[model samples]
Target chain A: ETSAKVIDGKAVAKQIKDEIKIEVLKMKDAIGVVPGLAVILVGDRKDSATYVRNKKKACEAVGITSYEICLPEDSTEEDVLKHIADYNENPKVHGILIQLPLPRHMDEARILNAVSIDKDVDGFHPLNIGLLAKRDREPFFVSCTPKGCIELLHRYGITIKGKRAVIIGRSNIVGLPVSLLLQREDATITIVHSRTENPEEIVRQADIIVSAAGKANMVRGSWIKPGAVIIDVGINPIDDPESPRGYRLVGDVCYDEACKVASAITPVPGGVGPMTIAMLLSNTLDSAKRALKFE
Target chain B: ETSAKVIDGKAVAKQIKDEIKIEVLKMKDAIGVVPGLAVILVGDRKDSATYVRNKKKACEAVGITSYEICLPEDSTEEDVLKHIADYNENPKVHGILIQLPLPRHMDEARILNAVSIDKDVDGFHPLNIGLLAKRDREPFFVSCTPKGCIELLHRYGITIKGKRAVIIGRSNIVGLPVSLLLQREDATITIVHSRTENPEEIVRQADIIVSAAGKANMVRGSWIKPGAVIIDVGINPIDDPESPRGYRLVGDVCYDEACKVASAITPVPGGVGPMTIAMLLSNTLDSAKRALKFE
Candidate 1:
């Protein structure tokens, strides 16, 4: 049986960070300015804090200044919005990111809406999403995770144009935005969600498949078309007492089985996860360039 | 061979207008207020004028006040933006629509972005489009033509949930918005565009297909799935030298051929076209109720 080639997202992410570092240095030399990314984290969810810290570290590595605003778990929506407004006015801040799961007491939609469109590095704001939907307009920022997936495809020389691509989920952050990006790349796109019937059969027809359903090992080997490429975006945790964390991270696709049938695939731990931070740094650098009117 | 049932969009539009007229009357009686729709036409394109005239006539039929602003063909972008600003602030205006295909010199995106999201009856604003993309949040207005397509399916009692649906074209106006709406309705959605390969085979699998590609007779009978429901949104002008104007109106689907294979289908000129105007009136009424805080 022929084995699939593993697409190393971690290596590509490192390559991109290195490229961004050089650009940041050139910009600093040319304009005596450094790109700044301001992240507003409401609540102290261990996972959210870890993600924010990783983002800050990524900014520092890329030579961009990271501005961290840690709000208490019980912070008022107004408090969060005030910080976002301040970041919008601050010329030094090129991108404003509000970590997700902003306290259950706060309205997620309303709070995300408060972020200015120009500095919306998270790209959750409606205007950025709307511009993305309209292929004619270039959005100030593309959501990080999905943008990372596309960059992976581009860097790997995947021909998205005229391809039969199926996406297995429709979440705003990953599935929907990635579908939009693929469509813009001219792929015939199909989106399957919880309500889809015969999803396995539908998935089997794709030349390229992106599984983001957050269900561990939901896509088995038999569901894949031989020689097709797969990007598994789901980072699902399964109970495993053998692991240090009491659980092991798996993806929506059964990797061991998929690697045998697929032509190319992204591994769970080294796949989409690393690409997210890489794209965040890229968006921040791009935002600063646009704001500063530098090429 | 069984023939398909013709879904008469004109009769349905009239029924909806009548329903809206009754509501308009009730609002007038309860609050002594009438819904108002403002249309700004920048150029003298015959088609744009015709569309504006139809919108005005539809408004009058539903007892809504119609506000019309006609600027010269060479009107500056500032002229149109000034009118949009006026309508945005006008308390009487419940819905604001800017006729599309604005003069080439004017920036369409910038001008449309100026309309307030509250009164964006045309629903072209990015914020509204973004809101639609997020299934959890409902936009103040859905683009009229796409809303009309969904309304036809609802009124016909064609189940959308769990159905495999295919949409042709990806125009922000129709194809993209309708896909989002169908997904919201729980239909598994696929979008095919110009660069799609094996378009026929992909479309042939759909239980419901919406063709908005603007290519006359592009969807042939052989390409349809047996007993499928078809909505033809394309309004293409074909050169026929037939009875009047040396041209004729046709849809993306081959009407004579599709009627033979499909279970239900909408005819071109009378199908999706009339629904657009009806939806505009419905949206205007909805806006008034929302603004006035009436149930």
Candidate 2:
């Protein structure tokens, strides 16, 4: 029986949070200035609301002041823009986040672009992404999920330079940015999207694989190369009547099979999920430090 | 005895220039407005001067007005910015281009960013590049070299979707953007850079190869898969005793061997080189059409 080491993203995230907490306290002591993250949530979608609440709690835990505005479902686009304008000029708000999936009726790009590039902790700005894609330039912030994936690799001391990395999606938030990040780390990057043929062959060639396809158990054991490192970003749910929730969370990789073939792999529930919030906090802290000229 | 089709960039560029000329005439007839391109040249580099002169002649041939500004090597950044601001406000100028390799004293990024995004015909602006990288969003203009490379593939009727494409280089102008363009066309992309291990092994797997590494005759026949298509963007010069210029320009791919191995390929001097200015003219015409709202 082959035993692969499971990457513990939850534990790593905790370690990172602890580090940020110390830094936040140090800044507060030095300048009497607390980092603040202002979140604007337009709709009350259960999932979005839960995400916002968790973010607020995480901010408070790290000594970051959290400001939140929850508008009704029918709120106009102007209502959201006005709040963003106010936060952009507010000295206390170092980072501004508009909880995503804003009302479909509203222009998503327009709203995202409205956020000041300096205060765009989420790193969704086109200017930020452009800089991230370009060589010899740096983005103001990298999106949370992709940054978390790279952080996991760094914490594990995985060498990315000269490694062959294959990313199994083209998502704006995770897959594309993660590919750019891996390339920046000097990894040879290949992106396999839905249109890719012979994906198993391609996956077999990779020394590192990042699966963000969002399909439950799509990567079988046969698709992996021996000793390859796998980072599964998909948090898919499969029906499980026996479970209390009526469904169980799984990843894009077939965990049982992948564990046998791969040298290291991340678990579904405890993997990339927790790192997102931790990265958000870290970006907010960074933005505050930059704003306050704190070392 | 193997024969492969030569992708003649000069012929194709001529075709594109002819097409742009027709469009320019049609738009002028429809709106009584001609396209205008403003070029800002800094310093006395002979190469930059030649490029500006060629671009002005091309613009004139296509029924477009060309504006030129030449500054001394010691021109301050403010002086350059002042000219850019004036062109940004010029109603007749629909496209603005700042010749690269500015004086050592100037901040290149600051000057490039100062150009208004709408008239950034060079498409070097980060915002334009960011939009190009993002799926479902279009840039105001794509950088000329990368766009010329794609235009060649289209004119040749090469299928990019589901192809395994390998790009050798990561320069912001050619390799990176070309990879994005190929990926957008549904080709699975692998970018092999200086740090990539076993680049030949990776390159052999590609059905399409775009080499912009500026290394003369780096790709050989044995490195290519039979029937694969190649686009060579390298313009490296090697010593040649018989040539009066003392050197001859060569592509990254050894044309002698690659022609026999690949089904189709682009040659240096007559390929990719001429297409850059053609694409620039096309972009200028496009900006004018967009500005005039001509159908």
Candidate 3:
């Protein structure tokens, strides 16, 4: 029997960036404008900083301008709000992203909501989500991670229409939004979570499975049906003494075992992670085009 | 084999209304305030009128003040918008409901969005829907019909957590919202639609099933898993020569056959229909309490 093909999300993301770079060049030559993305990061958390820096690099590679605002950990919510208000009014800033996990004192929801819907490239705002849920309405943006999941499917030409797709988790950011997108594409969708009884049995029946439960190795080879396509979104740290960090990153699905049974599967670290940044840049480009009326 | 037990929605609604009456009486005694509901009905469609009238009677029975506005079918969208704006600013109007299926010439989304989120009892606004989707935030109100479906499940003390639920539609009104609600309650949720292949096979795996496809008898006994609880939200009129109206109401489920396989089920006319109005009153009561700073 042939083992499952590994879906190279890292390569797909690079291809997308290259495609976007060509468009950015054309737009620059035609209108002398480049897409602008503003990232507001609160505090000095290492992870958030690394994420922001990586986003900046991605933006630059695509020929888009990147703006960063680093706020003090003790900064008042109003201080963050003022910066968001400034970006919303700035015509140059086509996309605005507020790095998540703000300090406890800050109201993350209020700050995120303050960003203009047109400039909300992160797609966390309710208006965009609501529009995304509806069939007729068009959302200004879709959340990055979920958009990346769908993009991987499209890039690989994996058929979603009329398939039985199971989503593991119901978080607003990934599981919920992705389910909406999948259903819109004509896939029958099921969401299984911690409270779901017999999750393994339910999952074993899916033609396609997206695991975002944030649990490590929750889905094993035995839980997968032969020929099923798997998109593993969970990034969990498991104890690995041999590794310098004392822990290693893993996905919700057991990748080693899944590859033997599944038709195609995405690997942790190199898979969904890279796609998120690619989709962010993609959304920024769309926002710039929409604002400039050049699309 | 024992047949399924019928869930009496009319009785449950009366029970809820009686409970609301007690709360209203206590509020009136303590603060001299009563919940007020304002309904805007456009056109002379018999169904819309009947719905509006039923709401009025429900309000009266529960000791809530009722207000109605009827407009001609030819009324411009602005004419309705102005009324909604007036109600939004009125301190006494705790709940504003614009009867659905408005005249074809009017803008439904624009008119509904015009109402203040505080008084939007119908919960059609995207903001509320977005908030509902998020686990951390509470929506001001849930759409009535879906809310009613959950209420029936709760009233019957049927545990939703960890159960596999199959929803047989994805319409914005009933199927979608209820799926979210079920997920929040910790039930594994699956949504099957027109494009779903082998719908019956997928549905047979559910422990709890909600049918809102608007297709008469789409779910037969063979589609049900033994001991499954069914909530039928579809209301279709079919030719019945024996009936005086020439057409009789039936749900998406084949009632006769379902009773044999299901553990418990709700009847068509008296099941989901009565619960919608009941939940409307419940939401209006909650709005009044929130506005009055009473919980």
Residue B119, candidate 1: C-alpha displacement in angstroms = 1.4
Identify the superior model by DockQ, candidate 1 or candidate 3: 1
Interface RMSD of each: 0.7, 0.6, 1.1
Least accurate stretch of 10 residues (summed lDDT) in model 2 chain B? B129-138
Compared with the real two-chain complex, what DockQ does model 3 have?
0.73
CAPRI-style quality class for the chain A–B interface of candidate 1: high
- Weakest 10 consecutive residues, lDDT, candidate 2 chain A? A1-10
Model 2 gets an lDDT of 0.94
Q: Which candidate, 1 or 2, has the higher DockQ?
A: 2
Candidate ordering by TM-score (highest first): 2, 1, 3
Q: What is the interface RMSD of candidate 3, in Å?
A: 1.1
Report each candidate's C-alpha RMSD, comma-separated, in the order given.
1.3, 1.0, 1.6
lDDT of each: 0.93, 0.94, 0.92
Q: Write model 2 residue lDDT over B1-295, tens digit each, in one string.
A: 7867999999999999999999989988888999999999999999999999999999999999999999999999999999999999998999999998899999998999999999999888888888888886888989999999999999999999999999999988899999999999999999999999999999999999999999999999999999999999999999999999999999999999998989999999899999999999999988988888878
Tens-digit lDDT track for model 1 on B28-86?
99999999999999878998999899899889988999999999988899888888888
Stretches of candidate 2 above 4 Å error? none
On TM-score, the candidate that comes out on top is 2
TM-score of each: 0.98, 0.99, 0.97
List the lowest-lDDT window of 10 residues for candidate 1 chain A.
A122-131
